[model samples]
Each structure stands twice: as structure tokens, then as C-alpha cells.
Target: MNERFNKLRQYNTSGLGCWVSLIIFALIVGKIGLGGVVSGFLILIALFFLVPVIGFWGFQWWLKQKITQAQCPVCEYEFTGLKNTEFNCPSCGESLRVEGDRFTRMTPPGTIDVDAVEVSVQRIEEEN
Candidate 1:
């Protein structure tokens, strides 16, 4: 989970870097009077925003690929969602906790046991 989060973070950082550089490049071109060319200006505008948007969407898809479904230890209910520190069981209403890649049932009163059962990761089929 941490690895996936780090990968997404790196993607976001790179996207931001690209956006900044493109903005700078656009500013330089505008200062040099290339902005007078409508086509060049339009292309620059598109690149200044479009590249980061595409990158963000691609990273989102990658992040979704890394997520796997986890079963509720208390109710055996399966759930497909992002990794979170805590979540409620859909079937039993039990609070569930996540540590690293492991999902376990949280004890009542908000306490986590040392011997919590480990939830298995269910494989997700990729769509074309």
C-alpha cells in the first residue's frame, strides 16, 4: 500500500513539475512575441494544461490497478476500495482497520487486538 501511495505521489510530483516547466516555457514564448501566432499560442496553452491532466488520469488508473478487495474478518463480506486506516464493515457494521497491506477487524470501543485475523487479497479482473 505504501509503495503504491509513493508511486502515485511521485507521479503527481512529476506532473506538477511538467506543468511548471510548460508554464515557464509559455511565458518565455509570450515574452518573445511568439504569442502573436494564434496557432502556436493555442498549442502552447493546450500543452500547458493537457499534459498534466492526462498524466493525472493515467496515474489514477495505475492506482486503481494496485488496489485489491479485502474481506471483512467479522462478517466475511468482501469490499473493493482504496487502502484506508479505518473503515466500517458493510455487512456487520464492525469497524475495520488497515495496517500496511493487512486488514483486520477492530474491536468494539475502538481498540485493535494484537492477534487480529489477516484478510486475504482478492484478485481483480482487468477490463479491456
Candidate 2:
């Protein structure tokens, strides 16, 4: 899951760069004009802005879905609001690191306990 997230992030970043370049190109074209095709030029300008707005919104929505589905490894807490790399456990007050689908606790060097920490897999619901 981490690998998949990384891939998606990379793709989004590349796409944003492409969109920026296209915006620049559109500006240049608009300034120069295309043999007096004013309507077509206006349409191109609208698309130049529209495409990036849609892409950004879609990317944010997808990220929100992934964050909501994340489960804490220590307290089994499902994250509900904003997504971030680090979050303090609401139930146990432990600091946890979120990486894709995996959650890890940040513990002191000598306080590690193998048996006390309970690790459980979250069950997925099946549709009938």
C-alpha cells in the first residue's frame, strides 16, 4: 500500500508540473493569437484553468478516502479529520507514524515491550 501511495503521489506531482507548463503555453498562445480565432482562443484559456482545478480537486478527494480508511496500529483508532504523517494516539496518547496503510509507534529505546502491544488486523466488510 505504501508503494502504491508513493506511485500515486509521484504521478500527481508529475501531472501538476505538466499542467503548469501547459498553462504557460496557453498564455503564450493567447498573447500571440491563432490567425484571429478569438472564440477558440477563449475556449483554450478556459480549459487551461479548468483542467488543473479538476485534477487538484480529484487528487485531494482521493487522498481523503485513503486517510479515512487508515487504522492506528497501537490503539486501533480510525483517523477521522485531516491526514498527516504523524498523529498522537487519541486513546493512548502515544505518538504514531503513518505511512500508507501501516502505522508504527515511536517509542523510547528501552521501553519496547513485545507482548504488551496488541496488533490486530482490521476486518474488511464484504458486500452481498
Q: How many clashes in each candidate?
A: 0, 0
Error of 1 at 4 (Å): 71
**What local distance difference test score does each model get?**
0.76, 0.74
Q: Model 1 Cα RMSD, Å?
A: 24.8
Question: Residue 5 lDDT in model 1?
Answer: 82
Best by lDDT: 1
Q: Residues 1-128, candidate 1, lDDT per residue (tens digit)?
A: 67888876754355788899889879877777664667677989999999999999999998976565878777678886467657787788887786556567766676655566899999999999
Q: What is the lDDT for 73 in model 1?
A: 73
Assess the local accuracy of residue 43 in candidate 2 as a C-alpha lDDT between 0 and 100: 89
TM-score of each: 0.43, 0.43
